[model samples]
Target: MAVTPGEETLGSRYRSLRDLVLEELRDQIIERRLAPGERLVERDLAEVLDVSRIVVREAIQQLAAEGMVTVLPRRGAQVAALDPDSALHLFEVRIGLESMAATAAAERRTDVDLARLDRLIVEAQEATRAGDRKRATHLNMEFHEAVVDAAGNPLLGSIFRSLSGRALQLFRIGQDVDAHGLHHEHVELVAVLRAGDAERAGAMMAEHIAGSREGTIERVRQLVAEAEAREARG
Candidate 1:
């Protein structure tokens, strides 16, 4: 939905304002433009986004509900931190959901769906080779969503998408890693699915996700320690 001028100015159009704010914030969060645990001053965000305080508050509350932001008593809101424990917990949940989805998709795979997945895999590889991290990440998401869609389970797909958003946030906070390795994993996953090996495909999917979680957690821990030392020295 388009943001109306009146809604933008008055911030009374809760639905549109809420969605717009979320979209903007989601991009920032995913890109790590707004780093984890960074304070989100409503006044600063309102001024920067050209929205009202009401809109900012509503948007932040929605993000909090999504587990993307945290609201603290007397301290206001900040981007949610990606601690090691939380990362492991979220990845465990994701591995279970995605592995099941991959198994179901292998069993229910259609020729058309396979073709689309192949195309996405190729696109992701090309993006990675060209050093376009944003496009690569976008295609990575599309490939996974395609698998979930092929599973023909709307509930499962919805859950995967939500969890994937959180995972993407964790991924972004880590240093820029080349997508080439992940692209190869995607290719192998497609091969397993095409061969109709549900068990093997599920195992591969789980392993791939687990590897990503491990890499991201390690990076986050390093960054956290560096930040702490910097603060101590100051």
Candidate 2:
């Protein structure tokens, strides 16, 4: 069945305008084009996307449910701000879920799954080498998501997807400073997964996520300090 541009088949009908809008907004958030605390005005978005206000509202609500935005009583929706505590909390939960998923994936991975992950990791490495931070970050996400899918656990996979959405915002911000280091971490993770050592793979996944969280916190703190210093000088 051929899928139309706006209309997918019955099996894929869920990929509607709302999903499209959500992805567009998500990309903005990930690239920091829509910075934290930026208000998402429904009328503005509708005009920007050439979609109806209903579509914009639904997309904003989905983002809000994913913790990427907050809908205030009268102030409307705005991008959620990241802080050290929230970053740490998200990583703590993600570490447990992702580590277990990687372990299970390693134990049950098929050749096809392994090949896909390898391709993703290689693409990420190439992107990093080319200084394509956005592409590198996206491929890095795809690699981990492929691992979760290989685990063959729907519930766990859903949780990982949700966490990844939130984490990607902070991850992108941190990538401005540590893109190369993050690329190295992806290389190490792929190596562990390919080795089929579930225990070691799981441990490596946990450590990688935790290290990212710590690095993000430190970077945010540094930013805060610099801003404060500038304020004091003024």
Candidate 3:
């Protein structure tokens, strides 16, 4: 529960303490700086962030509602563990939403959007080549998110925000997945986006997501089994 640098800077800039706390806590969970199933003590996090317990509790509750945190009767609130069923359900929703996002992005994307995509693709390639799975996974999440933002569909972005945390957690669990293949698919998606072929972009996004499912489901199952085994041991 260590406070990262620049948080005090954020406090100064943001007028809403609760919003800031929510953002920070959510980022920690998504980034796995806060590990899955780890207890989130309000007193501890509140002291760390120099905020009130009310604020931290509010943030945790919001995360709970988003399914990023789980609250048990006696266990309090801990980071949520990903289950294979949740991943499969999430894949179904992402397939529909992200494919729509790609199609809309292809129609609405500007030169600025393309520039950001190009930069991310290059960085992702570098991370993959270096075998930096953590950074590569983060960049992969960023790439899809950028396309959603570029789509100019506020509702779509809202839905993505709701799911992005668990989606990131799932990606992290797939650390052993082929990084090069993921980056290659990203490049292919960008090519379609660059050409503004809406239908092709949509189909490409669907296929890209399906490929990720294929690569990642086994790892998801493995993690689930490991977690269950650990619980059994206890």
lDDT tens digits by residue: candidate 3, 1-234: 644655454446557988888888877876668877889999888777778899889999989988999999988999988677888898889999999999999999999999999999999888888888778888989999999998999999999989887788777776666777777888888889989999999999998887778557777788678878898999
| Candidate 2 per-residue C-alpha lDDT over 1-234 given as tens digits, one digit per residue, 9 for 90 to 100 | 111223432223355878888887888877767866789988777766667899889988889888999988989999887667887788788889999998998788888888898788778888988988888778777887898998889999888887778877777767765666776777777777777899998998898888767678887677557656776999
Clashing pairs in 3: none
Error of 3 at 223 (Å): 1.5
lDDT of each: 0.80, 0.78, 0.85
Model 3, residue 101: C-alpha shift (Å): 1.0
RMSD of each: 4.6, 6.1, 3.0
Candidate No. with top lDDT = 3
For candidate 3, what is the TM-score? Answer: 0.84
After superposing candidate 3 on the true structure, give the runs of residues whose Cα lies further than 4 Å from its correct spot: 1-24, 27-35, 73-75
Q: Is candidate 1 or candidate 3 better by lDDT?
A: 3
* 1 or 2, greater by TM-score: 2
What does the lDDT come to for candidate 2?
0.78
